[model samples]
Target chain A: MIPNIFRLTLPILFGYVPLGTAFGVLFATQLDYAWWLAPLMGVVIYAGAGQILAVSLLAAHAGLLEVFVAMLVLNARHVFYGLSLLRQFRGAGLKKLYLIFGLTDETYSLLTTRPRGGSPQEEHRTDVAITFANQIYWVLGCAIGALLGRSVEFDSTGIEFALVALFIVLAIEQFKALGSQKPLWMGAAAAGLALALLPPAQQLIGAIVMVTAALLLQYNLQRNTTLTREANHD
Target chain B: MTEPMYLAAFIAVTALATFLTRVTPFVFLSRHSEHPLLQHLGQFLPAAVMTLLVIIFLHRSAHWSAPTFGLDAIGPALVVVVLHLWKRHALLSIAAGTVCYMLVQQF
Candidate 1:
């Protein structure tokens, strides 16, 4: 039955392995570190964009604080991923730690949207299976690409665009599930504002902050309106 | 680059910072799972966050100053969206979009 998880994770396997390979190739070619470090970071860091970003940062000889802050901002969206899964992950047990650790953008999207199993135990098992499967694909891909890095001579210029494609697909799925475009519009406005105002490194965090504030304000107004409507009915 | 020995420390710090971001909400909000605010955020946050991520990624990947003026990215992005809306297949959309992007970028 373990292989059953592969069926569920096939798309992610396709996504992570190639993306991880891209990271591995970049790491091998860009940094002074050994090729092995590419897969090592894949195992420990487990974030595609963050790992890719680290390649440039390390190449530039960035300090620990700089790497830390950059990674935190780049991954700030993960905070909300955990928030969305709090109830679903309640009985995940020891795997819960791994779950949180492995909550990349793709994993979180899959977890939120994948159909639940028959029971909580079954669901937790599926969750762990999916999470573990994705990481293995990523690490394996990283190892392959690192080994091939020096020998390969092809251009990898636009391969990272796979990530953009992945996110676009996920965005569409989220829209279908949520059945509203307000969030999309809000996101576009906030991201546009951030792009115009912030530097490249700061844009993600700026967009997150603006979107979060707008969401909170919208949520409060919605609650108040609902309360008022209930009172009028009474 | 700096000494190779410092690389380990850098990796350690990066992993910790990323973990903290993913874990912070669960650490602070697990006990408040049933709170109305948490519930509301849970209901809508995924959609909003996903949208934000998509926009940010598209913006980051584009080159607004280039002669192509971001078409390399925007064209493939549109293909991803349109193809997914039509086919509703994730892998197909991503593969097609990536190929489209590579073509535009290289040629």
Candidate 2:
């Protein structure tokens, strides 16, 4: 289990460190923000999306209330991920709090695939271990980034697009893992439709609505397909 | 912006909010069996979340009316989609996209 965790997390660790470094450099040089604050943001926020939003809001001189509201809405999905994994960490004893706190998107993705038939205690340990590993990687990345920013002639121009590419890859991976084209198509359609209908400020809300509607459509389609299969069997 | 004060406040507030979001569900769920509505919602949340993320990516910039089909932007976007569809790796997609973006911008 330990070896598996290490292998799984190593890629993420490598990828995030440089990206974190880019972020640190951007904050320190471009924004003229403090150097140490970059890693501090990483450890505290632990969210790629939220960190970007925070930066944009700060740049725009957005009020604190606006930043808070935006962060809350963007991160509301984590609530669902946490709820789904509740049973896994229910009896985690002292580690439960840390486990929950470390439940980033990457960590959650890694934890969802625990091999079956372990003792509940073992399962809990594995979940917590995976979560810990991912957070440690993020922290390490952020720290390296902060330190690297001091001497290196760091350039952040155009690096922001990396996040977009990362998400596209993640979306494709989710599609492959779920073995369904319906969800992907639904997501793309919803995004396109929302862009057409909503104004800029309300675009996020429109996308959320479309996504929820797409999920419902997928659920119904899936349910009907299953019922038909069962009927055929009967 | 005074660096220390802004940084300190940003860290404190963000940390508090993030911690709350992460911890709330664990506390609620550990106390009870999963409710049916929660389960149903959970099942759909990932798709919804991913969809929203993609929308943000596509329309983040304010210049929606004048889409810049510049190679610096569109080239990388296309490369990312292709590499992701083919390689299915996050790191590769990012590296290829970045390189594509840089190369296009240089020319």
True interface contacts reproduced, per candidate: 0.74, 0.44
Among all windows of ten consecutive residues in candidate 2 chain A, which has the lowest summed lDDT? Answer: A107-116
Best model per TM-score: 1
lDDT of 2 by residue, B61-97 (tens): 2133434544446567778889888876656777788
- Among incorrect, acceptable, medium and high, the docking class of model 2 is acceptable
lDDT of 1 by residue, A1-234 (tens): 587788667767766877888888888888766789999999999998899999999889887888888898888877878878999999788989999999988788778776665798888888888999999999998987888886767765677787778778777887897898888788788888988899987777787778888888998999999999999999
RMSD of each: 2.9, 5.4
lDDT of each: 0.84, 0.65
| Model 2 lDDT tens row, A1-234 | 788777656545654666676566556655656566677788777876577667777677666666667777766656656755776677778888777778776676556533447888887787777777776666666666666656766454455565556556666666666676665566677777767887765665566566666666666787789899999999
> Candidate 1: where are CA atoms >4 Å away?
A1-11, A56-70, A154-157, B1-5, B65-67
Query: Model 1 clash pairs?
Result: none
Clashes in predicted model 1: 0
For residue A120, model 2's alpha carbon misses the true position, in angstroms, by: 4.1
